[model samples]
Target: MSRAKNPKYESMSLEELRANMEKSKKELEHAIHNKNILEQRKRIVERKERSHRLIVKGAEFEKAFPLSRDLEQEEVQDVMEQLQNSSYNKSIVRQVYIAALHKEQQQIAEAVERAEKGDDS
Candidate 1:
């Protein structure tokens, strides 16, 4: 047999209804407080993300503007133009440009091979 519903909810006096309304209001207030806390957490995370993006952007800007190189800008540009025209393996180009003794050259070749194999430290 189905149980009967509570009479207080089914047909309450005015005072009883007001009491129930007050209870509902308190629950609603608690929910609003929790929502505000969640919103504050979201803002904190968003701020952190924005800060990380700014840091990355700053690093990129520095790379594109290497400090104290202004005196040699023209010469650097000329070499850069030559490198662009050469169409060389740019990754190993720095090592190739530095002349070395025979033993050092052998070591460099081995290092490059290892690096290409994803094994170099």
Candidate 2:
């Protein structure tokens, strides 16, 4: 609470203050509900984006290894493990990761430059 009170509130009748407090409480609850809905929508959009990326990766995987499409989850895990165990695959993965990192950095730099120029969306 504040040490000082507003004269407006001090002059309000007890019933009027109670009504005003209830109205404020309802507005706060409504705002909280709206915030929760927006958060939920954001989570859903994130999940959808992740799902799309996974689906695209799966499609790419199937294109690379057609026979593996029919395999079970454990088999896929085994294949991934085997790939990871291979030095050639590890090197390839590293190269791809580095390329991706560079691309991301370039994109970020471009975005920053745009922002500096006040042209960023």
Best prediction by TM-score:
2
Regions of model 2 farther than 4 Å from truth: 118-121
Q: Write the per-residue lDDT of candidate 2 for residues 7-105, one digit (tens) a residue.
A: 999999999999999999999999999999999999999999999999999999999999998999999999999988999999998999999999999
- Name model 1 segments beyond 4 Å from true: 1-10, 68-121
TM-score of each: 0.45, 0.83
Best by lDDT: 2
How many pairs of residues collide in each model?
0, 0
Against the true structure, candidate 1 reaches a TM-score of: 0.45
The lDDT per prediction is 0.79, 0.97
TM-score of model number 2: 0.83
Candidate 2 C-alpha RMSD relative to the actual structure: 2.3
